[model samples]
Target chain A: MENNLCIAGFGGQGVMTFGKLLATAVCDNTDYNVTFFPSYGAEQRGGTANCYLIISDREIGTPMSDILDDLVVLNQPSYDKFVSKLKMGGRLFVNSSIVKPTSDRSDIQIISVPATDIVVGMGNIKVLNIFMLGVYIGYTEIVPSESIWKSIMEKMAGKPSLVELNKNAFEQGIELGRSQK
Target chain B: MAKVLMKGCEAIAEAAVRAGCRFFAGYPITPQNEIPEYFSKRMPEVGGAFVQGESEVASVNMVYGAAAGGTRAMTSSSSPGISLKSEGISYAAAARIPMVYVNVCRGGPGVGVIQPAQTDYLQATKASGNGGFRMRVFAPATVQEAVNMTYKAFDYADMDRNPVLILSDGVVGTMMEPVELPPMKSDDEIERIKESKKKISCIGHPLGERVWIKPGVWDTIMWENINKDAEKLYESWADQAEWESFMTDDAEVIVTGYGIAGRIARSAVEIARGQGLKVGLIRPKTVYPFPYKAYEMIDYSKVKAILDVEMSIPALFLEDVKAAVKERCPISTYLRSGGNLVSREEMVSRIKKLASR
Candidate 1:
């Protein structure tokens, strides 16, 4: 089984980093094969930045897919650009605090998480990706929670205290997502 | 050991380190800037030297110098940057310097775009530099292959006392995937490798003996000798030509490509086969040697046609395919340029159309 995902947001929203973390976690912690393909160049100039990731049980031939099984967006433009490309019945996770997805697609599952509000409670917007990932795992359970926690800690290895904040942010997201489910 | 997921750029740099590359010199270019960025931090950690040359010319010459002194030296660049280094690359060939250079190719007759394109096939395999020099060029299809090819490139260079080129495109250079990294070589091993070159190395030798030619005097004999030796080395590389044949045994139509395009074609061929099409793939892992023998081994009686797919307009790689097939079958091309990828669906459709004809 191949799981294709496109995580997109404005620059500095940790979109690429989130995909990298997921790819790395799957590669290092599980038996799955993974590929992370980032979209570089002009779009990265303070504009919409994105990356494509594939986690598969078998060897992955292509790093990208035309239609993504999961579309994670943090802003409105990203939502507008990617919502139609999501596979029917695919999972859509949006940061509802900043992005209000106006797509009238009832075919897919949409989980609007108020990530900005939650990160605001933590007084840091950078942990927004960790919170979103927490919500992603809460719904999908692609990998276990401890695996993601370890991956996050390893990624933030040098910055010890920020790990604590990110962990807390992730826990809050997981709790919110569980209640919604 | 646990596997790691790494971008192609970082994996190559780390592979260079593992392969005992002690000196790296390069300028920054899109889709390949990560090589220098990783080397700048990594080389020093391993007690190696790293130079961010002001330009591609300076960078290649720096690598040439390091290779001459018996260090496993490498330089990486995109298309235009590689064009700038052509002169130094020629000098390295003339001097029989063993070095590795990576061309993370981008679309270009000129600096076209930063996205992946294989337009440098002719530039890399046919005429990398003046004086008719040839280097073994390995085109990797996957990230794991990229790592393996890069890790072994230094050895190939050292064995032949010539340059080895890893001709990757933007896709293979920037994409991230899981790879089982090679074991790192120790400092003692590096020193031993360097020490073996003390007899002929220019580092501590007399200026008269080490220089290729006298400063102001023309030396026709010296030029002939260098060319003759390079000619012999180039001919010896025929034994090392490598190719991959994917289900070509009983296939009627053979699809041929190199690098990432080849990988795409293999997948397309497999999918077409599931639909009962007799399509197969011949992918050249080593493009400079061109693997003509592999093409010649095809059963001409059963094969109906040959399809050459690449990410270049005018299809530079097709010339080699044509030469190998010798007009035994109708040859068709599926090509794209200006940083556009050669899509698998397009390849499958083209192969199917050719098969029907």
Candidate 2:
């Protein structure tokens, strides 16, 4: 199976980091072929940032694709810009706290999570992306929870305290995602 | 060996380190900024040196001096930055210094968009420097190939005493993927590698016996013989050039491309074949050696036409493909530029149309 995903948001939303964690987890924990391509330079300063990730059982032809099997939009502009590119039966996960997706498509699946509120309630807004990743894993199960947990630990190597905070956030996200049908 | 997931630029830098690259000097440019960035941290850890030069010209000259001193040296830049280094590159070629350089090309005739494009094919292969010096240019379609080719580039450079170019675009340089990284050379191995260059290097020799003293450039005949010998070395690479042919055994129409464009074209050919069209692909891995012989392997009687695909407006690779085919069959081009990729659907449609006729 091939999963072509686009995660987009403002540069401060950690879109690139979220994508990297997912790609690296797949690389470190599975035999799956994965690629992550990010938008950087001037775009990273204040403009919208996005990352295209492809996880496949076969060799990936290219890292960039206009057709997304899944799209995660953290802000309204990202939702507006990328909503049109989602495949008919594709899945879209949005941040309900900041983005109110206006797309009227019934064929695709939409899962809205209050990720910002979830992380803010946990007293650490920096763990927002990690929490969103938990929701993604909960819905798709494309990557195992154990793999992501281990990846999170490895990624946050130096700061032991932040690791615990992110783990808590991720678990909450998974719980929220599991409740959404 | 175990594999690690890394971006293409970081992997290329790490691979060069493993190949005993002890010195690196480069200016920062988008898409390739990571090469020098990675080396800045990595070089120190490996007991090597990294220098962020003031400009591309200074960076390449620093590499020229390092490589002349018998260290495995490297530099990297994008299109406009590479243009600035051209003169220094020519001096390296004229001095016969073995070094490695990377051009993570972006869309450009000038300071173009900081996105992937193969517009520099002619600049890299046909005219890398002002003296018409030809480097053995490797264009990798994937990150793994990028790693493997980069690890091997230093050897090719030292063996031939010429600059070796890794011709990658921003897409390949910036993309992340899994790679089986090669083993790092130990400190002793690095010293040995440096010591192995004693015969041609002026590092240890007295000033009286140095290359500058013996052949100090007032002699026009010596320069003529040097150019003649350089031409001969370039000609010998024809025997070692590399290319890949896919589904060509029964193909009636052939598609050709290089680098990432070639990778995209292969997918289009596969899709066309699934739809009962006899399409094949010929992808040249080495752009300089040009792999002209690969075209001769095609069965001209059955093949209908050749389609050249690229992400350049004027289609730079098409020139070499035409030169190789030498009018054996008709040729067509599908091109895109300014950060646009030629879509697989577009190529498949073109191939189907060609097959029907």
Candidate 3:
């Protein structure tokens, strides 16, 4: 099976980091092939930032795709720009605190999580992306949740406080995601 | 060592370091900035020298000096930046300096865009500089292949005592994938490599036995001889021509490309195969040698049409493909230029149309 995912948001929203974390986790833990490609250049300076992540059982082809099996949008502009690229029956994960889908698309599934508000409530906004990652994993179960936690630990290895905060945020996201399921 | 996930540009830098590259001087350019950025951090760890040259020309010339002093040196830049470095490249080629460089190409005739494009095909294979000198150009489709080619590029340059090119583009440079890196050359090995070239390098020797190395030869006969030797060296690279043929045994349509375009075409071939279309792919791993034999070996009896896929407007790589095919079958082209990428769905549709015809 192959899944093409695009994560998009404002430049400082950690869109690329989210994709990288997932891609790295899958690559380091499983035999699945993965590729992470970012939208770069002038557009990345205070503008919209996005990245593509492809995870496949077979060798991946192009890292960029016109159509996506899944799209994660953290802001309204990202949702407005990329929502059309999602295929019918594809999954759309959105940050409910910032993005409100104006279109009533019946063919796709929209999973809205109040990620920004939830992270703010947790007293640290930096873990917002990691929390969304947890939500994605909890819903899809594409890989084990422990794999993601292990990846988070590895990425946040140097800072003990940040690790604890991110772990708490991720667990909260997983609980919310499981409830949605 | 186990595999690790790395961006293409970073992987290329690490591969160069592992290959005993001790000196790197390059200017930063978008889509390939990571290469220089990587070297800035990595070179120090390897006990090597890294310089952020004031300009691309200076960077390339710095590499020329380093390589002339018997060090494994390299430089990288995007398309327009590479144009500025052409003079230095020509000098290195003329003086027979064994050095390696990379063109992480962006769209351009002149600063076109920062997105990936295969528009530099002609510039790389036909005319990298004014001297009309040729270099072994490796076009890798995947990060793994990029790492492998970069690891071997130093060896190729040293073997021929000439410059080498890794012709990559923005797509390949920015993408990240898992790759098994080559083993690092030990300090002793690096020292031995430098010692091997001591006699020919610019190291000081007795005045009576001094060796002069200059790109220019005032005598016409001497320049002609240098050109003749370069031609012979290029000719000897026939055995190094490499290409990948996928399911072409019974294919009625053959698709061909190099670099990332070639990679996307391979995927199209697989998708078309699932649809029961007899489509195959010929992906050239080395663009300079052109892999003419791979085209020559195509069974004319089975193949009806050849589809040349590339990301260049007028198709710069088409000339090489045409020369190799020798007009055996009708050649069609599917092109996307100026930072636009060729998609698998489009290629698959094109192959189906050719197959139906």
Candidate 4:
């Protein structure tokens, strides 16, 4: 009984990597089967880096999610383009620091958080991916926060020191999530 | 379950899918592009793998790689793109890994026109690659036969442990007709090969040290030396190629062609028969076999000529037909190329003219 998530942002916003990390985390750690598809290269450059994820108890053949339960937009263009595509009652989380004038929908729960500002204060601007990943977990526990940390370690399986910095960034993201709500 | 309207190229792809070919790798090449496009989305829906490769070389190599991993993998291409894959095709033959390659032939000798031509007949039967190995070559005259025979290509490839080519022309590939696809291989036949990767070629020893080796130089040499009996390799592909014969029991003139040319030749023979000409078609479903026995069994007393028609420039199959029926009858060529298909009326007129001369 997992959910479908769409994470979108500008070219270098780490949206594709974040989606892949979540997919790998779910597939490797959780019981929920997962599928992930990313837009890359020619068709994707300068437009938006979007990824569709399908997480369910059964086999998810098509990775593309026609219906989205959670949508996270990291830029104004991404927010403007994908806001109306979310399923009814779905949660919409906006990085208000970069994404301005977010959509106003009465039936959907909207979180306006300065995700990048929190990561910038943590002294590592690269931790923005983790900060948004934390918001994703807070809205819907599709994958455990612990698995995301494991995923960071797994991703840097060949690197040692980077793992330490990512673990710290992950903790800082959790702290930001706690202080915001 | 019954006849379905499908393009000839699409029928070939559908048959390969029904044959339990779970993996397909190919790039877009006209005259044969539909083969991959038809199966790209369809194969994945049924838990199969489909990859649109960067190029024909990469595509065939992907097939070779996946097939060596114990999955039934296939690829399709036309003349120009197929030329790039000859290296891999030879490698597949040398490895005897059983891969299906479909060549929807276009007019060739260069970047030939994207029109139906049996120009690759020599390239297919004889080694276009740098080797002495032969691939099992098939030529289906009709769309329905193309669908039925495509699965046979996979089976023969696997059973003989050799590469098999379904050589069709542009007309054969692009033409649409009613094709009733048979369940190529039983579900169990392929199910047996599902876990085949686990033992069929995987290395042995402690789990940690056992590297995932495919059908490579080590295994091929090891098996070759293990079963050094030449008869084993000979027996492997003895029954691989075959064909079809109609009214050749007592007739003299044998009209030889394959794919679209063969289809046109069939109607030509019928029209010639209506004019009291004793002409009959020798359509080869598997051109590699050449039906030498059928030609040898021809009643030479009544038969005076063998008219060989093809889309290539007197380039292929004509010589093979000559050798098969050298002492039996005189063989002549009615060849055409560069994007033109032989019509039925023209074939009949040619047969009639040849008979009179």
Candidate 5:
């Protein structure tokens, strides 16, 4: 089985970090082959930054895929730009706090989470991406929750307070996603 | 060592460090900045020197100086930056200084898009500089292969006493993958490797014992002999030609590429196989030597057409492919240029069309 995902947003929305965390979690814990590729260059200077992550039971081919199984957009521009690339019955995870996206396509599923608002309520707005990650993982069950948490801790190792806030944000987001399902 | 996730540029840098590279000098450029960035932090830890030169020209010259002094040295840059370093590379080649440099290629004839491209084939293999000097060039398809090739490139440079090139593209430079890094060469091992080159190195020998090494020979006959000796060295590299032949034993149509293009083509070959097509792949690991023997070994009686896939406008690598095939079968090309990658779907469809024909 193979899963191709594209995460896109403005420069500081943690699009690349979101992909990197999930890729790292999958690569470190499982024997599955994974590749993480970022859209670099001018798109990174306050423009729409995006990244591609591929996870496969077998070896992965090209890291850049025209069709995606999942797409997480943190803004409306990213949603508008990338929604057409999603495959039929693919999932779209949107940060509803910043983007109110309406799509004409009916074949794909759209899941909206107010990740920014939720993280702000949790007292740290910076964990919005982590919260979104939790929702994606909780809904998809693509990988173990513990693995994502472990990766988060490893990433936020030196900052104890940030780690705690991120942990709460992630767990709460996971509950919200599970409640929906 | 356990597999760790690393960006391709960072992995190449670490591999070079483990390979006992003690001196690194480079200038920053898009798509390949991580190479010099990683080396800047890494070299100091290994008790090596890292110089962020004022320009590509200066950076490559610094590497030339380090290599001449028997230090394992390296430099890296993208397309236009590499063009700037060509003269330095040629000088090193003429002086027979052992060093490794990488061209993490960007799309360009001149300062094209900062996206990945395979546009430097002829420049790397044919005219690196004015001297018509040749170097062993390795084009790895994956991050692991990038690490392995970079680690081995230093050895090849030392063995041949010539500069070596790692021709990578933007995708391979910026993408991240899980890699098993090579073991670090201990300090003593690094010292011994340096010491092995002391006799020929310009590290200030005692008076009257110095062997002056220069990149130029003024005497006409002496230069001719030097060129002749370089020709022999280039000829000997045929044995070092490396390639991967997949499912080619009875393939009716053969697909071939180098670097990331080769890697994608391999996937396309597998996809074609799943659909029950008689397609296979020939991936060149060493582009400079061109792996002509691999093409010559193709069973012409069974093969119908040869498909050459690359990310160059007019297909620079096609020349080598043509020379290898030698008119035994018609050759077709599937090309995507200007930083666009050749997708697996396109290649699979092309392979199907060729197999049907």
Candidate 6:
């Protein structure tokens, strides 16, 4: 019962990687069958990348999502590209560091966070993706926070020193979102 | 298992491997090249064998050699490449060797485009080989069907000691879909399959203990004896002939095609019906043992005309449908070629336009 999550951004924003981590964490920590698919257009290199995630108690018949339950829009172009397509009652977690506030919609949930700015304030620019991921976990509570954090550690276990910094950034992102709520 | 999304040619290759097929030889051609590519990678993983021959001609002959070696063997190519393999296909039939051939069809009677087409129907079903040898042809409309038929083709080939072709089209080949793979059969169960006219499996002989017969002797009494024995072997393809029927009982028109064309026709029929058109689709799953009987009992009076949609210009398959439904039902054709796919919208509109006529 997590969600059909989609992440879309520019070529190197780790848009696909964020989806992978979310899918992996949900599959490992929850009682769900999950699929993570990264699809791109004709360009093989330096083009946009989008990831499709379906985590459900039931089997996922198709590995793609036509209507997203959750969307992580990383840039102005991505937010503009996918904003209208978000399902009513779905959440659009915007990187407020880039995109400006638009018209308010009654049917949807909008969480505005300067995800990248927070991570940069924490003295590391590369951990913005982790910061954004931490926000999704905080709002949804779909999977246990401890498990997602553990998955991040396992994923980055190869680089031991970076783990503590990412965990701190993730915690800060969660705390910042909670403070606003 | 369950169905999964897969490429058409790769599905057939995977199914053949699952069926205990151990040898594959092929040269690559678009639309169907992934079959060889699939086996080239996956066959080794399963401890089977794969070899890319010098040409389509060479590949078919290698399949023959492997089949002659008593291994379940297969090769895939498009229309032009199949022409190159004709001599070997004919030889395999004449010599009565059991194997599978996958023809992922494209447009034209010659070097056509790289999209899906059903233009190769006549060459595949009627006769592309010498001495009028007939092969059992299986045409699948979906990727999973292609996979299942590839396995069935091997069994059918071995049963009849003849070639069984799984004729697929470009759309099915290129589209990726979800599919569940069948479990691998046990080695003992594989060995338990009765070898049919296997001239390759010679026991109790090692190193130079065997007698090497000259090539001339193989053509003479030895060849005749092999064929004679093959004639006595059980044919595996005889009984499996079927077609899928959808709402044809009160159908005023029967829309017919096979493989990708058939899939398109199915969607067209559904739309045509929603618009109050009493049209039904007759998808021929097999081309050789074509379901002539399925059309025989149709309410011909209601079925005033039959629209035959195809990826090739009118010929072969259209001709077959005409012959099958000739006396009672009038036939019409809508065609696109050079590997272009005719849309369902176009077909339904065409049927409506012709309905008054």
Per-model TM-score versus the true fold: 0.93, 0.96, 0.98, 0.62, 0.98, 0.67
Cα lDDT of model 6 by residue, B1-357, tens digit? 444445567778888988989889999887777888899999889778999999999989988877776778888898899999998998888767778988888877778776667888888887777656678888887666787788778877877768888888776775444456766766665666624333334323567766331222445777677656544542333345678887799988788888877876876787688899888888888877777877886888787788888888765688778777866767878887866677666788888876666
Q: Write the per-residue lDDT of candidate 5 for residues B50-86, one digit (tens) a residue.
A: 9999999999999999999999999999989999999
* Model 3 pairs in collision: none
Model 2 docking tier (incorrect/acceptable/medium/high) = medium
Residue pairs in candidate 4 whose N, alpha carbon or C atoms collide under 3 angstroms: B116-B170, B252-B303
Predicted candidate 4 versus true structure: per-residue lDDT over B1-357, tens digit per residue: 544446678888888888889899999978787889998878877678899999888989999888777788899899888889998887776666678888889888788777667788888887757656666677877777787778777777767667788888776676544456877565677778655544443324466655343334656676565345323664455455477676666555678887777766775676578788878778777777566766666788888788888888955888788788766667777888886666666677777777776
Residue pairs in steric clash, candidate 5? none
Worst 10 residues of 2 chain B by lDDT: B207-216
Tens-digit lDDT track for model 3 on B217-333?
A: 899999999899999999999888999999998999999999999998988898999999999999999998889989988998898899999999988899998998888899999
True contacts kept of 2: 0.61
> Per-prediction DockQ scores?
0.63, 0.65, 0.79, 0.01, 0.79, 0.07
Task: Please tell me which model should have the higher DockQ, number 2 or number 4.
Answer: 2
Residue A78 miss distance in model 6 (angstroms): 17
Q: Rank the candidates by TM-score, best first.
A: 3, 5, 2, 1, 6, 4
Better of 4 and 6 by DockQ: 6
* lDDT per model vs. reference: 0.87, 0.89, 0.92, 0.74, 0.91, 0.75
10 residues in a row with least lDDT, candidate 6 chain B:
B210-219
Task: Please list the residue runs of candidate 5 whose C-alpha ends up more than 4 Å from where it truly belongs after superposition.
Answer: none
- Please write out the lDDT profile of model 3 over residues A40-134, one tens digit for every residue: 86874568999999999988888888889999999999999999999999999999998989978889988899899999999988788888988
Per-residue C-alpha lDDT of model 1 across residues A2-34, encoded as one tens digit per residue: 798999999999998889888888887899988
